[model samples]
Target: MTAAQYLNCLQGVMQREWLRFFQQRSRFLSALVRPLLWLLVFAAGFRAALGVSIIPPYSTYITYETYILPGLCCMILLFNGMQGSLSMVYDREMGSMRVLLMSPLPRPFLLLCKLLATALVSLIQVYAFLAIAWCFDIRPPLWGLLAAAPALLLAALLLSSLGLLLSNGIRQLENFAGVMNFVIFPLFFLSSALYPLWKMRESSEWLYWLCALNPFTHAVELVRFALYQQFNLTALLVCLGLWLLFSLAAVLTFNPQRAAVRG
Candidate 1:
């Protein structure tokens, strides 16, 4: 497709996703509600029991809610990404996938556009959660919020691409719930989302290593540092690399020709 045509296709895909998001109001509310529950209930319960030290990105001791804010923001993205991918599975079963694949645009470019569009939608939920957090006085610095935009977007792209990659392997909608639970909970719990890596190490060294190895952990760290207007080069590089790797894999797996050969 020509450049203008490709742009048009991208715009159309994004608009479709946006319209679908509004049509399913429950999805938007649930996305917001999950993080709010974590912030309001779960974090409150843990506040007294868990104490955070002055870590590199943090200048002083912070409340448990404050500490987990970035992780929870990422959690919003993570779930939404997988939800977006689940929609892909639904589309496939509904015969819409064939239509999308038959477009004049290159399949990889189309998939990339889908990934970008999904990432953009997930960002809306992330910022919404941040706004709610602000009302509760769980505020990051104003500049930190600005600095977080790129990091949040990167994290969104990383998770969305990973979700799309998983969706390509999913052959049936019936199995998607199982897959989502298996993938999402582990990624969220095993990372430094709820607690610090040091705390995890104190409990079990192996668990700490696992958290360190998790790409989601890097994504969380990228947001964590950026929320404080700081930069974690390691986190940035890991997230960037994983975003590229997952996007490439998703595109390859999404190829209709590959599916035909396998069939």
Candidate 2:
């Protein structure tokens, strides 16, 4: 397809995907509510109970609720990306994705547009959560707000690609529960989302190493740094690299013939 044609197809698919989220009001509200509940209720309780040492991006003692805001925001984007990709699989079975795939644009480009659309929706939800956190006085640097955009987008991209990879592999919703249980919680808890690597060190050096290796750790750190209006080259590289890798995997898994067999 010509460049203009490709751009048109991308825009069209994005609009369709965005409209899908709006039409499913319950789904959108539920997505927003889950993260808000975590930030407000669970994190509030934890803030009183837990003691966190000062870490990079945090200059002094901080409430647990304040500390986990970025992580919870990341969680919202992460889970929403998975949910959106799962919906794509359901749409494929229902023949909607087939209609999307039949567009004149290149197949990979079309599929990527879907991923971008999901990422956009997920990113917005995260920012909404951030706004609420600010209201609660869990403030990050004002400049962090603007710096967060790219990091948030990259996190959404990585998660969305992982979701696409899963949907491309698992043909039925029935099979998703186990993977979600096994993958999602472990990735979240094992990372620096809830605690610092130094804290994890007191528990197990191996656990600390594992968190260091986790791409999600870098994602959290990227946002944490951005929240302080600072940048970390290592964290940036990790997020960018993982995003590229997962996006390639998603594209490979969605290839027409390959997708058919998996379905």
> lDDT for each of the candidates?
0.91, 0.82
Highest lDDT among the candidates is held by which one?
1
List TM-scores for all candidates, in order.
Answer: 0.96, 0.93
Q: Write the per-residue lDDT of candidate 1 for residues 117-152, one digit (tens) a residue.
A: 999999988988999999999999999998999999
Tell me the alpha-carbon RMSD of every candidate: 2.0, 2.1
Q: Which residue pairs collide in model 2, if any?
A: none
lDDT of 2 at 135: 90
Model 2 lDDT per residue over 72-173, tens place: 888887788789778876786666676776676777787789889999998888887788878988888788898889888888888888888888787677
Give the residue spans of candidate 1 off by over 4 A.
257-263
